[model samples]
Target: MRIFLLFFPVFFFCGLLHAQTVKVEYGGDPLPDKDRKKIEQFLQHEVDFYSQFGLPDTLSLQLYVFENRREAIDYLESINVSLPIKASGAYSPKLQKAVILGRENGRERSLAIIYHELSHHFVSQILGKRPPSWLNEGLSEYFEHCTIHKKAVRHTFTEYEQGRVRTMYMLGEVNLPTFLK
Candidate 1:
């Protein structure tokens, strides 16, 4: 009877673990092991980042890492049943998940996209609410320029590529103000 009582609670607790478990469903082009590990680590960090705010749950999030933006957009459009943003990554509120391009120029670019999308999920859960769209997106962008050192994440602001920016502006490129009418 003593053994039965002890084992029964353990068995019940196992099911609770299943209920809140996070599952990353992968589709599209095959990714190298290196990229896959990066994705997993970033996702784990995102959960820990938000959980620090004393959320009741562990901030479970699903990540879908596509080999390119096309595959990511295709996945989003199919599930969203609406036009998906044509971008490196996006967070889906309906699915409570993140879909992102796993590689572009390099691992750093991919890491930036991962952080940007993951931040969206983090802010919403950590604060038990979301900030305005502009603030949320700005925060994500700021976090995108981040570095992980010895398990510590540090965000750094980088100026836009100096040489390229100067050349483009010299060649008549302009920064137009956003006009929403």
Candidate 2:
């Protein structure tokens, strides 16, 4: 009877460990079936693209599409994070989770945000969560701009040169020395 009790506790613990499945919740307007399909395809493609860099595929990332900024802000706050946040999406290394809030009519922008956040996710997974600030933010921005055409890059560069868009160094938000190094 003593041995049986010990073994039962072991079995119970093992079952509990195995039963902890990752949960992904979407807290916003339900996407239409067609849009959901497109979002899934896009996510798969982004996952594949990042996989080439040897990032883990075990992320189990979840996405949320909020109807408006107010709803999105509320949801973000509910998640215990502050807002008017710089990034459109966030990757929580501790939680092994990612949250993306889509603008009501800004589907393309939301997709870019996904790419940006996933870049963070992949890098964090590969580097074990302590990637330098500059590399982290720059890489996220780089991935966000990955799909831009060559002409667009050139135009953007020109704008930067003309002081329309700020330079990386000028922004000084990221650690330029570490990034350049």
Candidate 3:
């Protein structure tokens, strides 16, 4: 019993050391260092948020940004992600990667896409398998609203969105059976 107690703290500290780590790799067009650092910071915020649900020992993320939709589509296809005609971003769990269609002037939208894709990665890490599309896409949609402030990250629906959801619920438009199907 004394030996067990002696090793317990060591094991606990080791687990904390290996808790979780995230590495980001960029491909295709070169990302500016400033933008890259911001993206990494946002990812770190997301990693910390999702850590409550548990994570793997290490998470390696590959991010590919393409200036053209065709190239992004082709790249995602090569990795076996069959994106629809108008997908702006996609995450591949098998490759631990995300491919995005870049818009030079849309920084806010770009961050939203990054957050959404990272949510998919976290969900995969937690569940070890894909959940239903409704749940998966719903989570991504909700997480896309996250904004990284200087001191914090925040994700919340606007009042309009809250009203819309409330109206939908009041009208019984939120069909759980069909959604779960």
Candidate 4:
């Protein structure tokens, strides 16, 4: 009984390491310290916004930024999932990590994607359940680009998603009320 009790604590601590509330591991690509700080600041702002809005408390998620899609995909595939065909960034709730393309898309887009994934993480906490694919995707796209201007918050939609909505509106496929609901 003493042997089992001692080993159990060791196993529990090991599990805790994989579930860090906050961790960001950079790859060999060498992200500049300036960029890293900016990213952290943006993420922290998101966390604060959600907390102030009466959502669940903040969550700690590990972030992995690789130099390119290949590296990201390789690392992702090493996990139990299949390779992503054309993804730049993603949040794996099961793993509690965000995997992203570090160098390829440049800072603006990369930051947008990171915010998008992190938004998903928080939104999941709000619903306390997995949202439908469209809701998950729409909310993420809505949060992908956030800007504060003169005490006003603006959210920019992804180009593809925005274009689709515009096209639908033009074609009378969607009306304001239907879209809102």
Clash counts for the predictions, in order: 0, 0, 0, 1
Q: Give lDDT: candidate 4, residue 118.
A: 73
> On residues 1-181, what C-alpha lDDT tens digit does candidate 3 reach at each position?
0001000011111335545567667786665566666677677766766676676657777777766667777677677887856667888888887777765538677767878887888888787667678877887888888777788777778788878877887899987566446
Candidate number with greatest TM-score:
3
Collision pairs in model 4: 21-60
Per-residue alpha-carbon lDDT of model 2 for 25-144, expressed as tens digits? 443566566555444444444455555565543455455565566666667677776544565666777665556655654766775676677677667876777889898888777666
Q: Candidate 3 has what TM-score? A: 0.74
Sequence-dependent TM-score of model 1:
0.61
Q: Every model's Cα RMSD, please?
A: 12.1, 13.3, 11.3, 10.6
Between candidates 2 and 4, the one scoring higher on TM-score is 4
Error of 1 at 18 (Å): 19
Residues 1-181, model 1: lDDT tens digits: 0001000010111223431223455545555676666656655565555545543443355666666666666677778634344567777755767776547668778778878877887777655455688877877887788777766776664666456656666786845242111
By TM-score, the better pick of 1 and 4 is 4
Clashing pairs in 1: none
Please give the RMSD of candidate 4 to the true structure. Answer: 10.6
lDDT of 1: 0.60
Comparing candidate 3 with candidate 4, which one achieves the higher TM-score? 3
Candidate structures ordered by lDDT, highest first: 3, 4, 1, 2
Q: Model 4, 1-181: lDDT tens per residue?
A: 0001000010111222331133344433455666666666555556555554445432555666676677677677788655355767777767766777555777777767777877777776666557677877877777777754444556756688789999999999999688867
TM-score of each: 0.61, 0.57, 0.74, 0.64
Give residue 133's error in model 2 in angstroms: 2.0
Error of 3 at 92 (Å): 1.1
